[model samples]
Target: MSRRTRRHITPLITAAGAAGAVLLSATAATAHVRVIGDVIPGKPATLQFRVPSELAEATTVRITVEVPKDLMVTSVPKLDGWNQETLPGAGGKGTRLVWTAEQGHEIQPAQSETFRANVGPIPDRYSLTFNTEQTYSNGTAVAWNQPRTGAEEPEFPAPVLVVDPEAGPPPGSAGGAQQPGTSASAPAPSVDAATPQPAAAEDSDSDSSLPLVALIGAGAAVAAALAAAVLRRRGARDGSHL
Candidate 1:
């Protein structure tokens, strides 16, 4: 190939690789919000929902998460220079939560924000998901409310907290057992040992021992005959002396 062709081809390959990387990053970012910090079952936990601003010219202004029925959200903590509120649900639970930045506090393009909430007595469950809504300064609102499907993630899938079923129980708690909403491990199977049978009961056992038993019986008979002959010879010698 000519030098010109090599140079042009190299640049194209590099550009393609860079574009592929950017596309992959964007695809991953659109999947869902993130849950930050330790998640312990049946105990207090601090959850942070991370949001990213996509459009290079737009600023993110609002974020809201719809809490599930099983979760008990105690409080929505405000970030510095930010506003927050907890909207009541049907059963008086914290159904919808929102966080906003005032005036010049909007999250800019390529920037991110984490909205945190302080809650207590986490449910004994394996996984918890909360649908979310993200709004920009330009009034573009998006929904993150579905599970993943192949390489096409939901435009805004919900945030999730997956609990470790085998995690030890909280301090001062009773048992360190598997949490609810989690699968139970199958138990190990039991086994029985083979029992030994009497020699007379098993044909193979008698055959294996017959040769040894015959040898012992023949040796005992030979020893008895030798002893009798020795005694008789000694008695005849004594009679001759008398």
Candidate 2:
């Protein structure tokens, strides 16, 4: 191509490539298992994990989450299609939670499920991380244990929860007793994901509006991603002519 034509086409190609990258990144991110909802530092909170089955042909059959030893998980509410098991930690608190799908209750490809547990009084911290292992029916296991440390996110980042100190009552406040913060002097016991105790009635009413808001936001993202792809294609065609 001529120099003038090449100059015009180069930026178009670059812009197109940038748009395509954003589209792909947004598409891939929806598959990550993520923690949802705010967690107060000093109160019992209902924490939820949204697990999405990423395989096209296989179903997700088992999920195990590593609970930090410093945090205490109280109970897990029963999910309709899964059975819950807990490994006890110090003082009868749960350290690891395992959820296995019942026969024919596996999370099929392109589907997702949510698991909830009562955890707290949360330790005083800025954030918490939960490493998760996902087992597929086809015998493949994917671990979402990689920590995100930089600007770019890890391919399979472990789910993380940010502690909201301002929202909840102060630590050791009445009706909201605080747990001791993680200490360097006293080593914490080795523990995996927090598991639940007895099955308790889940409060569906709390945070009820979040799902609708998330759905709307996700729809907008998908639309933007599609537009990005279209722009990339148009840029490619225009560049080819140049």
Candidate 3:
């Protein structure tokens, strides 16, 4: 192709490549087992975990989520098609929750499942990370237990729950009830673990918006590249006629 044609096409190609890279990164980040909501520093809260099957050829058959030793878990919801087991912690706290799927209940590729536990009088901490292990139908196991200590995120980072002190008062502290919520009719057996807690809160409003900002910037780059290509073609046609 001519030099002029190359100029128009090159920018378009670069823009598309950048956009694809951004989108792929975002998708990969969301594929891991993740905790869905925040918790108050010292109150009762239900934690929800979303686990997705990332293997292209295998179905997810089992998952195990760890609980911090300091956290008190009151109950686990009974899920259909899965059997739940809780590992006991010191003082009757739960350290881990395991769920095994029954026949025909495995999470298929590209599908996800959610698990929940009612917990708290949450320890005074900035966040909690649940190191999880996922087992696939093909006998492969993936451990999502890495911790985030710097600017770069680790491969297979563990699920994290943001602990916001401003979220509310601790149970019996103020507006909230004086005691922790009662346990479910059938609470899971508790276990103890020595999971380290973060020193301070790292999640913020700005951090949450970073992904959206990157996406918008990528879309703008693509749009600009497309517009430039059209303008170049129009100019070429005008010159030919002249």
Local lDDT at 57 for model 2: 61
- Candidate 1 segments exceeding 4 Å error: 1-32, 90-94, 149-152, 165-242
List the global CA lDDT of all models. 0.67, 0.71, 0.71
Displacement of residue 75 (Cα, Å) in model 2 is 0.8
TM-scores for every candidate against the unseen true structure: 0.54, 0.55, 0.55
Can you write out model 1's per-residue Cα lDDT over 64-121, one digit (the tens) per residue? 7888777778877768867887886647765778787889989877778888888767
User: Per-residue alpha-carbon lDDT of model 2 for 1-242, expressed as tens digits?
Assistant: 13642233221112323322121235644678898766666788888989988766667787888778888888899999899988754375548788999999998776889999888888777667788877766555668888765556777788988785445543433324534575535756554335533332244544676899999999999999999999999999999998
- TM-score sort, best first: 2, 3, 1
Q: What is the C-alpha RMSD of each candidate to the true structure, in Å?
A: 13.0, 36.3, 32.3
Clashing pairs in 2: 65-193, 66-192, 66-193, 67-192, 67-193, 67-194, 75-197
lDDT of predicted model 3: 0.71
lDDT of 3 at 59: 77
**Which 10-residue span in candidate 2 carries the lowest summed lDDT?**
10-19
